[model samples]
Target: EAGRRNLLGLRFPPKYGGRGLRWEDEIVAIGRTANTASLNADGLGIKLGEHGEVHVNASLQTTIPHIYAIGDVIRGAGLAHQAMAEAELVVEALQGAQVDATSLIVPACIYTHPEVATVGLSEEQMRAETDAVIVGEFPLRASGRAVTCNEVEGWVKIVGDKRTGKLRGVHIYASHASELISEATLAIAQGLTIDQYVKQVHPHPTISEALGEAGWVALNKPLHVPRIQRKRLRK
Candidate 1:
């Protein structure tokens, strides 16, 4: 049954996120990504870590101080957006603005059949960092958008600090997880709590709505999933 549904989806991809995209004009590849840093500062004598990634300071400077390194050359998620953010920070530092080279809000995504997108701390990482944590999940099966697309195999999970109600992370496994995660990244980066996040309205009949629903589930004021299930979501 799962196989049939997946094959059907591949044959006729749904226009998720309200875009008029077509699978007929797409190229697909399957493989593991082995990304390495691009370093050309050899003659300049740049210091490298054990893994050979360039070592930089809070200002993204090499051991030489005058030199700077950003993007894949440094230890990070090796994402283009991350590299761009680092570049912007570097430019600000050069202009004498206070900047933090480290501590980037890098969101990751696996662009597969059921895309995986996430930002902020994971449940395990959150548990280790904070004393209290709560997780709220909204299954794709419960989403009206998912039902319309006939692809309801994944879920959206939200992690938050129970004490402060501040949203810690957003993890999504759905068709347009990549497209849906930008909002989550902003929320986590700005340190918006569940209370603040849920106050913003999500449009009806959309996959993004599941994120708000997950927040509601976390606050024990769920409007989509079973109310009793919210208890087991906390740690």
Candidate 2:
């Protein structure tokens, strides 16, 4: 049945087994399943002592100021990009640039089917922390480029601070979402407002426009999605 569904390019409903799992959850499930099957998992590593990771301060300095740590050894998502960012922070600090390492926004991406990528807080997290949150979403099905590529399987979501109009997060679940997330990461990291993001002109009929469209939707100024559809998304 699953094979037939795949052959027909049809996905089962989530209740039966469609795309129901979050990217992180899927990774954990794969690791656990691999362990159960006694497979040599790529993530298997040395079980370090109780104080495994060397704790770092805002300046990336370890508990002992003289020592410093970065990359996978630190308590982070362990992505190469994160390591590179931390490395730059450390270099700036060394050069007496007065860097604040904690301010860095590390973007994460899961390169799965209909890639998942995100930067900053999620809707759930933002809602829990603050009531004044605005969410805007652009379904890929409405995107010209997505339809052209026949990869309109997901959406792009932007979470903003309603009171401040500052972009708080950007999440994408679509083809090339990993690449699309960088723009959002920059927006969030630089504290760009929704207006600022939307004002910039995005090339027509491109996946990148999804981000801009989402920004407009959050502000209740959608251009592509009909009013009825907008209302449904707001709900």
Quote model 2's TM-score.
0.78
Question: What ranges in model 2 sit over 4 Å off?
Answer: 1-51, 231-235
Q: Report the C-alpha lDDT of model 2 over 1-235, residue by residue, as the tens digit.
A: 5554433234557522375332212223422111112311123432222335445778888655655678766666778998998999888888887877789998999998989999999888988978888888888888999999999888888888888899999999899999888888888888899989999898988999999999999888898887456422223
Model 1 CA deviation exceeding 4 Å by range: 1-43
TM-score to native of every candidate shown = 0.80, 0.78
What tens digits encode model 1's per-residue C-alpha lDDT throughout 185-225? Answer: 99988889999998988888899999998998888888878
Model 1 residue 124 distance off true place after TM-score fit, in angstroms: 0.6
Number of the top lDDT candidate: 1
**lDDT by candidate, in order shown:** 0.82, 0.78
Clash count, predicted structure 2 = 0
Error of 2 at 204 (Å): 1.1
